[model samples]
Target: MAGNTDPLSPRAKLAVTAGRAAAAASRAVGRGSGSVIGGKVALRLDPDLLARLATHLDVVLVSATNGKTTTTRLIAEALRASGPVVSNALGANMPAGITSALAGGSDAKYGVIEVDEKYLSTVARDVTPKAIALLNLSRDQLDRAAETRMLAEKWREGLAGSKALVVANADDPLIVWAASSSANVVWVAAGQEWKDDAWSCPSCGGVMQRPGDDWFCGECGFRRPTPSWALSGDHVLDPHGSAWPIKLQLPGRANKANATTSAAVAAAFGVPPQIALERMYSVQAVAGRYDVVSFMQRELRLLLAKNPAGWLETFSLIDPPPTPVILSVNARGADGTDTSWLWDVDYTRLAGHPIFVIGDRKLDLAVRLEVAGLDFQVCEDVDEAVRQAPPGRIEVIANYTAFQDLRRRVGN
Candidate 1:
């Protein structure tokens, strides 16, 4: 009797329970094994499940500190020029989230996944993608990612035995170093045309200098070689200072990196460079990243700020001051549990003072501004902040969770 009623039975009750749960989850995800809601549910159940699914499909994995979502989406769109594709439209980068994305599109011929830095190595091992694109690595989410070196090491470990074609950013030292270690690699660089900041060498802790737009280590002599695929041309018009004329719908230098990276990945896959550029020009705003919207007779630029690197890049793109800035901070599970990252952003660069601060953590942002010796108006309600802000050129910066909330508040 005791054996018959065992809750931890080897194959009977446990198998039944597991089967039922899976079936319910499948049903919840909807037909064809795909649904945003369903994918999210699957992730909640198991994080490594996506890697298991990758073995059955053609996968293309993209990882980076910034621009992973836009770059992943752009890659998917470029591939779509040839055939059907599947991807996580919401920028879910974890193992389980990737599985959720796959489960949603069981019929797709190709899979495009944006992998989080922390999980890239694990996912790469499990998925064994056909090709992997390593975009630039920047300092972001210090609480979760700790340091960029840690992420670089993990990527090296995960991609050790991968036979997949490697697409690397020649402009970035970390990417150049990673590609050097790989056997099958195609290097892509943004050319010496644009001016941007490059990080220090990961090996000797020396400054990695850029001879052109391409980088080299001053002390270690670990410079990146010339890229096989390069974005060349003089005075390549960056209309919005975000790398333009290639047809970028977003604003900021980060967006340009995303576009260039997408073009490189597409070219590696044999997509014509001209065709890729055409598609890039045809694309529109991607919701949160530098998306412009109309609100209350004012033009609102909604930019997502998830970490220090992203915020710094966004701030750098802002046109010279006099443009009012409205920043919103929230404690959404997605923006991370810690709100201390706000202190890392250089708020003084806004030209003058922040016109308004909103969201649940208004005071928190206000305190940060004060510590920086910058003046700001704090509003407990997002709507009040939007209502009170002067109508004209305005910049609205928000985290992942607060983007939509502020969007709705501003009637975007």
Candidate 2:
């Protein structure tokens, strides 16, 4: 049975009970999911509530600028093949939300947590995971988060001398440098399409030499490690030299990349790669991402792109031109108040599509599109934009807050 409180101390048990009540109240009022508020209330009542609950479960923390939630979901699903698993399937990666999730799934044998990149160290200290997935690090929420290189450095410092087995991306130079200090690491050659952030070496601030798939810094002589797992076009090659075709229901190379690391992480937990991959095939949509919602007599497939790197991957996933694309962006606290990252994304790729833009920062996106020699219509909202579109299925791509707005609107 889930939410069993017998293992917790009296103080922690009371905290968990109060947190559940608050969560129920929040959902009743429709303020939000109540995950974060509930956790905050519990933590305030008991500071060590997370650590107390985590002591009974084998935890795994997944952190990355993109694909954190999806990868966490895949890892959790894979672990479920062995026993019960609990996770923050929603995009609430902070401490409070994580606490609430752990409290709800008290009896789960495995705890798969999706942690925000900025809060990874703090959460890692409390959870003491059995394994940690270090995915690619790139620019995201520049106003709120630190630079990618600095984040990599922080990860290196945080994981130093830790006992957890690290499953990391070998293709990403930043990821490689970050996980270098861990005693045990399983490197996976998950492709990095966005390389603007890692051209310079994080080690000696020297220019990195990238001849082909290999990368190395000339000044400090830091080089790419040999990956035990590598991703070829449509298949993943394991440490044993055997290749398996990655047949996931999810779309794009990015999701395929995510699946590769997920399988490796599941292997750390004693689940076979084949079994993990089989479980991952069932996860079609993650927190409304890649979810195709029917709206106004047309199908709208939602995709999330929070940064330049994310936008690049999203371009490949969206349906080709002729089909309308609704791009919504918001400059709220969640989306990063500074909209300067807009200029970093290449809007030219979307030139052929009939684009409909909406959101708080629609004007900012429209300006960028215009400068890139593209035509777009700035609509009042998603409903207006969809009603004005031609027909058939359309793609709705948005940033963090804007994505949530559309997800709520369509009831995804």
Candidate 3:
């Protein structure tokens, strides 16, 4: 048998197959614990993985409470206009997922990965990016993220020793503070303004008054400097009561921030503003984040609500309550280990009767809706709720896991 051996091509194929199977098995075993989020599993790897990947190409990291996925996708798309770029298109933001993306795209010239707030420190320490885009910080995942300030501090410490160019949202107080402390920083400001709950002076804990379009601390006199790249001079045409423009492809004020941030990052990479604007106009919404799909002769607007800030931003974008709203909430560990944050959401803005609710944890959402003095019907089946909802103007609010299930069931 040894004398008859030749190139051994069959054995080589078998070895590759076995290696893939082992990796898949390891991922499955790792997911048995409670560390991973979304469908991606987290696993430890040798430090050489990052070193090997870093030698392949430059990396860009985008992180924020909201708009990270959209901005990351946009930046990746814009970068591809020049050359090949690799990204975590499935909304993976943890260290394991980042490693998986990099390992999978060893040949790509550029890598763009969105990092979650809680995991930014870990990612920053592991992956030394060429540039880091730090979007605004907001109250999110209260259980997982102790507080916005704590996350900010972790981020500051994570990037303190790195040589990455920092692109920050200057309008955000938290980001402004981080930018001021960083030696190499580019500030990007969005023209649109809203009264956020957490915009205050980081140094003195005083109210940061908006003097004109810019924000300044009334007590301490600290203020954000004018951005190097700013999006201004356009009014959001709100034909409906919502503060969103009717002309936008994505229907929300939050999307404006995403668009402007994307433009800024693209411009930083030397893409012209006109090209960025055109790209923004042509961009499509990712699945489950303000994704509007047509099914059964009606439009199903699926918005993913993860935390109180996200819910508030989404609620502010919805047009005046259409008749018969369909709201779904799931308490599955995949969606969220705890559903107590539902209490912080203001469901009273849902101005209609008999709101249809569906999910494994419909009772919890129903209880919250009841406490808010809203009428709702508890349906365990999402398909049933989708079918039973009236034909006129349907808005489906789903948490992370339920959004995917709802999309699959609704054929969108």
Best by TM-score: 2
What lDDT does candidate 3 reach at residue 23? Answer: 53
Q: Give all candidates' CA lDDT scores.
A: 0.68, 0.92, 0.67
Steric overlap count per candidate: 5, 0, 0
TM-score of each: 0.80, 0.98, 0.81
RMSD of each: 7.8, 1.5, 7.4
Please tell me which predicted candidate would have the highest lDDT against the true structure: 2
Tens-digit lDDT string for candidate 1 (49-154): 5554555567889988777888888888887776678898677677645766765554566789998878777777887888898887766654566466766766
- Model 1: lDDT equals 0.68
Clashes of 3: 0
Off-target runs (Cα >4 Å) in candidate 1 are: 1-52, 191-200, 207-214, 232-245, 295-298, 337-340, 371-373, 408-412
**What is candidate 3's TM-score against the reference?**
0.81
Error of 1 at 5 (Å): 41
**Please, what are the lDDT tens digits per residue for candidate 3 over residues 320-404?**
6555667777766555567887887878888563489887778888899989998777776856766777667677777777787
